[model samples]
Target: MAHLAACAPLGACTTKQNASLRSQSARVVPRAHHADGETQAASPALTRRGALAAGIAAASLVLDAQESGAVGFKKELKDKRRGRTRIPEEEYTKELQDGVKYVDLEEGTGEVVKKGTKVTAHYDAFFRGIDASSSRQARFLNENINLPEPYDFAAGSEIRISKSKELPLPPQALTIGVIGMKPGGKRMLLVPADPWGYGDKGYAEVPPGATIEVLIELLSIGEA
Candidate 1:
């Protein structure tokens, strides 16, 4: 993405505005034409004034371009979200589907997850050991459960949820795997790497194609 200043041409200034800007520039930077056809040099003060005026014009253009870009970007995001294919709501069940194996530690009596529902949960993720051996260490990867307060999902915990518009969103292993879960439920999910657990592009300490275990405790569900 280009900076606002760099996208000034994208501002698309109107003809009237362009003419007005040219007139202002001409007034600030006067050129004296001699009878002998020699051009007289402008005064130092006038030169500085012209430069300042030009800078202000550029700044205004940058501001306009930035505002336009911001508005367009927001609209595009909204439209994209609207056009997205919504995942169908699943029937309430304890059975896990889509290659996601889960073990429910505590059953929830709250509302079940449906389309457009917003859910808040605290999770602890760990790199699963080979062959489910008791001797193998399941190294801790990340957690969002030890905070004093929740942010956007769990606030005031110094752990702010990222609103990044980047590619490859959070792992579907958790998002899709958590479908049909109700608030107050606790489940341990066994997530495979390909197309689920970071899709072969392992993040941070987790290696590529690594399997992971996520212990999730659902907090609340509300209207999105």
Candidate 2:
């Protein structure tokens, strides 16, 4: 059941996508904004040609984007072996041996990752990687490798970019990547499935595909 067995994994790598991520036409949407940074808000939604390239995919930000929430991003610090946590045990065992499949969702207050830290996250990335349905599945598929990045990514399996079953997506809605990391610093990224737009061969809202989610952060370096 590891998917991609032969059929329905990506439906034989289907093709017929005329362009996704919200049908682009080529930047120029901004209209206002200029007070502190001194004018810069033409808002083609902050351009790069809209979501990367706009069709099939161009932005989901990170690129296994399977480390989201309820593993709940936390905060608090002090250390010797264990005494503070907002997620820190060598950054939670280097995010579970860098395979992205760990979930300990409780037992906090033992943070200690010195260097000038700052972290903030609220994620959701599930099309079929298992974040709920509790039975005994926790190795680190809680998804969120910083959300928002696009410029021609192509939405094959889980890099989908379909969003618009009529327009109704607002579940903790995400965005806020690149801040400051270097105080015991660590950074991991992925999530570029074209703005989590699921579509290309994926159905049932988000399955038949699943890839994007791996946002790890542990900054303290230059504090900004």
Per lDDT, the best of the predicted structures is 1
The residue-by-residue lDDT of candidate 2 on 1-224, one tens digit each, is 01122334554533433232123323334445556655454655457566556732533433214233322242111121121223332443323212333233322233532222333322333333322111111122344222222211111212123454222221111222222222233333333334433334443344433443333232222222
Score each candidate by Cα lDDT.
0.55, 0.30
User: What are the candidates' C-alpha RMSDs?
Assistant: 21.9, 33.2
Worst 10 residues of 2 by lDDT: 75-84
TM-score of the candidate numbered 1?
0.41
Please write out the lDDT profile of model 1 over residues 1-224, one tens digit for every residue: 11122225767877777777667656664466789997776688988898999999999999999999989977864453232232222422333555556777788977877645666665545553212211112222333111122212321112233555121123455565456778888776776776556557776556778866655667787764
Model 2's alpha-carbon lDDT is 0.30
Over all chains combined, what TM-score does candidate 2 have?
Answer: 0.16
Clashes (backbone N, CA, C under 3 Å), per candidate, total 4, 58
Q: What 10-residue stretch in candidate 1 is worst by lDDT?
A: 129-138
